[model samples]
Target: MLKTQFPLASIFFTFSLAAFSSPANARSIAIDEATRLPLVKRAQVWAQPTWIDNTFNFDDLFNPATAPLGSPDEQVLTKGTIDCTYLYEAPNGPVGANPKFKCKTTAQPSLKLKVKYGTENGEVRGEVLGTRLLWALGFFADRNFFLKTTNCFGCSENPVNQKQTDPNSATTPVSFSPSSIERKLAGSEVLKLVPQADGTTKVSQGWGFEELQMVDAPEQLRDREALKLLAVFINHLDNRKANQRLVCLDGSSPQGCTGQTVMMIHDVGSTFGG
Candidate 1:
C-alpha cells in the first residue's frame, strides 16, 4: 500500500510541475508590428506636402498638381504607335489576357503592344487617364495612348480563315471583336507599348525593394501611402499584387539588383469608378 501511494504522489507532482512550467504566452509566434503590414482596406492614409513640376505649391497626394505631367527619367517614351506583339504571347495572347499584341512600327520601340477592350467598363480611358495622372504626379507609369483598333488585321499569331459579320456594315474580317468593337482602344481600344529600358528592372509585386535609393527612398519609394491615396482617388479597386511591378535601374533582377530601381503601376483596368 505504501508503494502504490508513493507512485500516485509522484505522478501528481510531475503533472503539477509541468502545468506550472508552461509558458505565460504562446511562444510559437511573436507578433512584430515593425515588420507586419496592415490589411489593404485598413491601411493608414496621411496627407503630406509635396512639390509638383518643380513648383513649391502646398498640395497633398489626393489633389496633385494639375500642371501638364512630364517624365522624371529620360527613358519614359510618352508618344508612340504600338505595332508589335508581346514577347511572352504569340501574335496575340490568349483571349483572356489583357488584349496585348506585337507590332512593326517606327513610333517607339517598346516592342510590345497593349490594347484596351472597350468603353463599357471604360478600361481604356481608365488606364490612360490613371497612368497619365500618376505620371503627371511623378509616379512611374507606362506610356499609353488612344490608338486605332482597326490596325489589328492579320495581327493574330494563329490566323483563321473564318469570317464574322460586322455590326455596322455586316462585313467580314472584323478585327474589333473581343476588342472594343465601336471605339478606339480607348473607345475601341487603348494602345501602349512597353517602354524601352536599358537597366535591369526589378519585377516585384508587393511592398518591398531590393536596393533602395537612400535620398529618394523616404519620399518616393518608401512611405508610399500617398500612392495608395492616389490609387483610391482614381478608383482603382483592383489593387492586387498582380497589378503592380518594379524594375531596377542597373538591369539586374530583384535579388541581383543591389542598385537603384523604379516602381511601376500597371493594368489600371478598374479605374474611373469601375
Candidate 2:
C-alpha cells in the first residue's frame, strides 16, 4: 500500500510542475511589464535616433521672419502613428528561411526648426496643407510636427542635401543648404520612405507623371482610386508626387506575389493656389 501511494504522489507532483512550466503560461508572464524589463530595454535601444542631415524646408511657404517659436513639447500635428518597422515584413514563410533585404522608413519626426522661426501657426499650416493633399488622394502618409531649438549644434541646415552631408559636420550659427546659408532659419517636416515586401514593390504617380516600373500586375481599381484622389488635390493645389508606390499580395505564394493591392503617396511639398 505504501509503494502504490508513493508512485501516485510522484505522478501528481510531475504533472503540476509541467502545467506550471507550459509555454502559454510563460508567454503570459513575459508580456507583463514588470516581468519584461529586458524587452523594454531592447525596445528603447531599437528606437534610438538616427539623424539625417540637410532635409528640405518650405519656410518661404509661410510668412518669412514672422512666425514665432512655440514650446518644444507642443504637439503641432495629429494623426495615427504607425509601427513603421512592420512595413518590411516579408511574405508569410518559415522564419530564417527567406532571403533578407534592406528596409528603411522616413516616417519619424524628421524636421527641426531654428528658435527664431518657430511659431505654432506656421507649423500648423504646413502640416494641414501637406496632410490634406495626401489624404484627399487616398494614399497613406505621416503627420508633421515642429521642434524648436535655440542653438544650432546638430540641426539640419539645408532642405535638399540633408542625406548627403556628414553626420558629424561642424556646427554653424545659421541655416544653410548646399545652395545657400542664412543667419536665421525655420525647419519643416519632410516625407519618409520605407522598403516593403519583395515582389510587391511598384510605385505610381499623378497624371502626366511617369509610372514606376514594378514586377507584378497593376491593380486598375486601386490605380483609379489614386488618380481620383490626385485629381482632387491638383484641382485644389498643384501637388506633385515626390514618391508613389503600389503593393500586391497573392494567397498562392508566400512571397507577396498575389494579395490585396495597396497604394501610397508621399511628399506634396507646398500648395500652389490655396
Candidate 3:
C-alpha cells in the first residue's frame, strides 16, 4: 500500500508542476513599439497588478497639494502654480494654521520642496516643454502632475497620473531614494564615468554641474556600453547636470559589487513633461 501511494503522489506532483510551469501562464505583458503607451497611461491600465500592489496610488502621492506652490515672485518649476503647502510643514504649532494650509501626509524616503512659483513662460512652462521634448526623444524620464487649488487642499481629488521608472530598485515605478546616502554616492560614481567634450566634464561629486577634468582610467572603459546609452539619453534631454542616475548590480558578482560597473540616472524631476 505504501509503495503504491508513493508512486501516485509523485505522479501527481509532476503533473501539477508541469501545469503551473507552462509558458502560457508564466508570460508577462509585452512591451513593444506598438504597445508602448505613455507611462502614466500604462500605469492606469496596469495599476491593479503593477502599481497598486507596490503601494502606489493616483490620489495619494501625486496630489498637487503634495507639491509646493510657488510665490508670485518666485520661479515655477513647471507650468501653473503648485501648492506651497506641499513643500513644507505648516508655520503654526500643534493647533497650526488652516488645515488646508498644512502639509500633506507623506511616507519617509520622499521628495520635499519649498514654496515658490516661477515666471509664467519662463520657469514653469519651460520645464514642462523641455521634458516633453525629451520624452519624444526616447529617454527614460519622470512624469509631472498638474494640480488645482481644490486638489492642493485636502479635499477629495485625483490628479493626472504620470508613469516613470521608480528610482528604488526594490519598489515598482522605482525612483531613487534621495534619503539613502549609499545611493547618492553610487550616483556620483556614475557621473564620474561619463566623459565630456571640451576640457571639462559634465558631472561631479556635487548636486549641480561644475567644470572638472575628465578621467581616462582603464576601469572607466569597462562601463562604456552602459555609459554611452545613459549619455545619449541625457544629451537628448538636454541634461546640463547630474540630476538622477540609474544603478544596477555589477555583472561579475551579480549579488555583490565587483567595482567594475553598473548604470544609474539621477534627478529625473526635470524629465518627461516636467
Candidate 4:
C-alpha cells in the first residue's frame, strides 16, 4: 500500500507534478509593446517567489489576521470616509464602466478604490473572502477590506454613468455623503514602479499567469507550480496583469529591490465567483 502521514503533502506534490511535468501544454504569452521591455527586464527580479523560511513558524498560517499583517478586530473596521479623485482609465472608452479612483484617508494615506454598482457587488464579497484565504495560506495579498456602506467624499453625482458621459469632467468639490459603497482598501501593497520617458513612474505591470512560465529559479520551482494550482483552486478567472502586481519588498526605483521581490495578488474579486 502506498501511503504517508502527510496526505496534504502527497496531494500537493501530485498536483504540482501533473501540471508542470510537460511542456506540451505551454503557449506563448502575449506581449504588450509598451511594457514588453520593461516587463522582461523586471522578470529577472519579480519572478522570484516569496518563500517561507525553512524554519518558518507554522502557527502564522492559522493566525493570518494577526500581526505582520493586522488583528482580527482591524479587519472588521471597514466603514470609513475616503477622499478620492477619479481615474481616466476605463474599459468603455474615455469613461469607465466600473468607476475606479485613487483615495486617501486620515489613517490610510493611499488606496485604490474600485466601485461596482448594481448586481456586481458579489465581487466585493469575493475579494474579501479570497484575500483572507490567500493571506492565511501565506501568500502576499493586499491588506483589503469590504464596506457595506461608506462616505465617498469626492465621487461624482452618478459616478458610474455620469463619468462615462464626459471625458473632460471631473469630480465635484470634496463633500461627504453616505453611500452604499463597495470599495477595496489597498494599504500596503506598494508595487514596483518603472521609470517612464517623461520622468514619471508607473506601477510595474504584467499578468501573474505569465510568470508561471518565466520563473526559472530552481529553488522556487515547486512554489511556482503550486501557485498555478492555487489559482485554479480559487477559480481565478481574470488572469490579467492589472489584477496582480510584482512588487519590490526592499529597495528603490531602477535598482528595484535589494532584498525580496513579492508577487502579490492585488485583486481577487473575479475569483471564487468565476
Query: Residue-pair clashes per candidate, as listed?
Result: 28, 14, 35, 0
Model 3, 1-274: lDDT tens per residue?
0011123244335323422321100111222222211211111000011122345332333333332222322123232333322322333222211121222212321323321122221223323233322222222333333322211322112111212212332122211111101012111122232245875543232122221112233333322332334344434253444443322213222122223322223333333332
lDDT tens readout by residue for model 1, 1-274 = 0011123244335323422321100011111222112221122112121333455332322122232233332122222222222123333222433443333222434323444544353665556566655554445555555443434433442223212222342222224322311111110011112223775433223332222222222433333544555666667777664455443334233123333334445557667753
Sorted on TM-score, best first, the list reads: 4, 1, 2, 3
Model 3 local distance difference test score: 0.26
lDDT of 2 by residue, 46-121 (tens): 0111121255122322222222223332222122111111112233322221111111112333322212123322
Off by over 4 Å in 2: 1-128, 136-139, 146-152, 156-242, 247-259
Instruction: Report the lDDT of model 4 for residue 79.
Output: 38
Best by lDDT: 4
Candidate 3 segments exceeding 4 Å error: 1-116, 148-239, 243-274
What global local distance difference test value does model 4 have?
Answer: 0.45
List the lowest-lDDT window of 10 residues for candidate 3: 40-49
